[model samples]
Target: MYIVNEGPNNAPTRGTLKRRDIDDNTGGTPIIGIPNLHIDEGELMQGGQWITYILHSDGISQLRLVRIDGQEQQTLYCAPANTHIANMQLSYNGQNVVFNQYPNDGGKPSLYLLSLASGSLQLLLHPQNDLAYTPTTWLDNTHILLTSFIPNSGAPRNDLYALDIIQGSNQHDTDLQKLFSQNWSCGSFDVSYDTTKLYVANCDASNGLSATGPTTISVQPSMGGTPQPIAHLNQAVTMLRAVSPTMLLLMVENGSGDTSQNGLWRMNTDGTGLTRLTDDTTGGQSLCPYSQYAWSNVTQDSKLFALQETDPHSADRKLYYGSLDMGTLTPFADIADGTDMRLVGWTLY
Candidate 1:
């Protein structure tokens, strides 16, 4: 499972990697022992075979690769001293990856791509030191959309753009056309299946991705323009994925120890049909959800949904999964408390 902590002040860590097998619907336990190395950030490739991840716990910041089942693991790339890999995204085909290099010298994050098969890594685009162009999602097999903040830009201040790797060539882009802009900072956003619309996760002015304030779900043209609000929540959002063109899967932070309010949530793009997928009703008592799996790799059609939950204010944590056929959430595995083991992607079989 590819994941990140929605917890406040927590950086992505691999220390929490606790694996559980998908229920075969047979009467068997799902817990699998943990691994040794800590993974900072990672993603299961589209092929569902390879796992592309970054390691930063040690002195050296590195990018590595391996089979999802602990096979052929090796370091793919490592950052030089004073530089750390920012956001890394795997291509849909699993043959390539794009990441941003953050330099301690205060330069803008430079985007680069590495071809796994040939091991050819090259710098793609580098913006001025002041701007940050972070990858959000792939628009298709070849195009990716990145978001940047434009403070004081009248009305909507955020801007979006499509970066075409194949056709972009060696030239850098500072003049790419803007897709659209929103009045608030969009913590997380995704594209529609048809590739014509955008689903945005905008947070309150002060909270940002910290989940301290309110969050609003909205939609707009893919090419960029004003965003139309669809749904507004009282709390901040930690994860947002466009499961279908009209459906969104999100996680909101209700509060510490507030089991009735926090957990996984699903809703239609229009903000109607809002439903709480995880709740205290199943646990028989209030259970706090400190983290969640963010990548939308697995869904209801996969037959099970997993949420990491725990008792409030302590290190007690467990892996919880809901069966689509049965429509209920059940504890699956025991995990070390306080460790950040976000879903990096899962191999169903």
Candidate 2:
């Protein structure tokens, strides 16, 4: 398994671990180190051969694509002199990659796209200072869905937009469409495996970004329709993914010392069979302390590769794997307490 060691301390490191070395009761360490790279957040390309990630080193941030085995690397794009790369998403088909740029070290972030086949980078949308842009998921190889709202508007809602990856193409060979709009600001969204429905988290924006408010889970048509509520959550949702056509994987934020409010959860699309897969306890003692911030850092295979930060702000952390069918948990790595670990999963060694 591949894991990222990010810090409140040192340069980020990447390494690989053996799944066999892990068990439910004991933790393990990386078996090999990935040279001198200082980047972390990544997702596998559709073919599972390459990974796209953001690089933050020296005084620059870049969007990069690297081969899985560490034998080759490529810098697909780099932020301008005083700017840096921010949010990013890779199409499910593995052809295109899109991300945002924070200019002047501040201001609205603009969206950009890169073509893996052509090595071409294009500005898809300009940065709007008042409105915030967050890439949600790819509807298809050439289309992506995202939500945006006025930063700190304190309003109760956000708008969803669809972008065409191919310069001259439309959603249906016509024009991109607004899939859905609601009264609640949606933090993130996912499409069912079959790509028929949109699963979203409707959140509160009172504190600034809509992600911080009380969150709710709902599903609606990918085209346009009224939403069908799934569950009203007490904690803010940090990540939401559809595991199967009828099931979902949910991670909620509980950074504070409230054990009951955190952990990995799974439920049916209709909101049935909900289960907490880890201990969301707050403390310096609990073996598993889940944080919503790293929710997107995952890799799925026979089971799941995930983690739990010991505290909201500390480096104490652990890597674990669990059964998607039973919601059973097991510990794989016990990162040294105070050793900030920013991360992901996959097997390269």
Candidate 3:
């Protein structure tokens, strides 16, 4: 796993990137240090040799590609002022990249695509009829899954769509196909490793932007089919990741005013054998009140993960790494004590 120890007060996002072996109880080795870097907003390439990310500073964002060793860095594209780039995703083949860009006007966000080989950037999709489009996942090398909804409005109606990049590589016009339109907001969703089934966590949008009550986990054919509800949870599920064709990992909100239910969980895709792997209330080295987490990789068999926790009052951060079924967690060392260290994605290698 790799972590970014953000710089001090002056340049918080500028700092050192380090890699660690979870199996070893030692501190990580430094990889590279970059200024104005948004480590979390980047994707590690397939071969783990390169990373494509956006750098935001002084109100401007730049799409950059850099080797892991901090050599041969290339600024692929620089956005105009007032443009915020986010939710970047590299294609499966590592040939193309897609991301969402929101303008300063707070209107609908636009999606853009960049070709790494040719360095050709194109306007992929622009919202129509006041809908904001966000790139969710790459179903294949050519097809990208997207979710559309209104921004900032109460209970924005959500729907799923797929964009055929090969057919829509031209400017501003996209070949889109609607996949689901039930109006129930999908808080989180993922496709099976084989890309045959889609797992979605549906939330009630009648009250507000967040889920009001129980959230339902459903499975359906990725192309299009009737969704089957497999499990329903009382807590709000902030994240849902399909770890394998038959297993899933979830991060549910601990809203019961306690740490008993605060942590990660695993469950079978068939909705059976649901169990909490990390029980902060009763386990060793509690990873309670964590703000974010990421699996080692997106592969179906991935079970290793890393999570980040921040001290709200002191504003300090910590990182922890462990594999599935291990209730106990060991604190990662060598992380600059007072700096803000963030858990970035794991390397494929």
Best by lDDT: 3
Each candidate structure's TM-score, on Cα atoms with residue i matched to residue i, is 0.74, 0.75, 0.82
Which stretches in model 1 have alpha-carbon errors above 4 Å? 2-18, 24-37, 105-107, 149-159, 169-173, 183-187, 206-216, 225-238, 254-260, 280-297, 300-302, 309-312, 323-327
Give the residue spans of candidate 2 off by over 4 A.
Answer: 1-37, 127-129, 149-157, 167-177, 181-188, 203-216, 232-237, 254-261, 283-302, 347-349
State the lDDT of candidate 1 residue by residue for 1-349, as single tens digits: 5333323223433233234556554422212222333456767665456666776654467888766556677889989899988678776666778888888665667788888889998887767534567676677677777766432332333567788888654436654556765443434677777777888787654433323446778888877677899988876565677765566777666433233565667778789987777654333222112111223334535555565555555655555667534538776555455544354544554
Better of 1 and 2 by lDDT: 1
Task: Give the RMSD in angstroms, all C-alphas superposed, for model 2.
Answer: 5.5
Model 3 C-alpha lDDT per residue in residues 233-286, reported as the tens digit of each score: 876565687766677877665434334565678889999988876644422222
Report every candidate's CA lDDT: 0.60, 0.59, 0.66
Q: Which pairs, if any, clash in model 3?
A: none
The CA-based lDDT of model 1 is what?
0.60
Report each candidate's C-alpha RMSD, comma-separated, in the order given.
6.1, 5.5, 4.3
Candidate 3: segments with Cα more than 4 A from true spot: 1-13, 36-40, 152-157, 170-175, 182-186, 209-213, 256-259, 280-303, 311-314, 333-339
Model 1 / residue 109 / CA error / Å? 2.2
Candidate 2 residue-wise lDDT, 285-334, digit = tens: 22111111112333344355455456645555665566666657665556
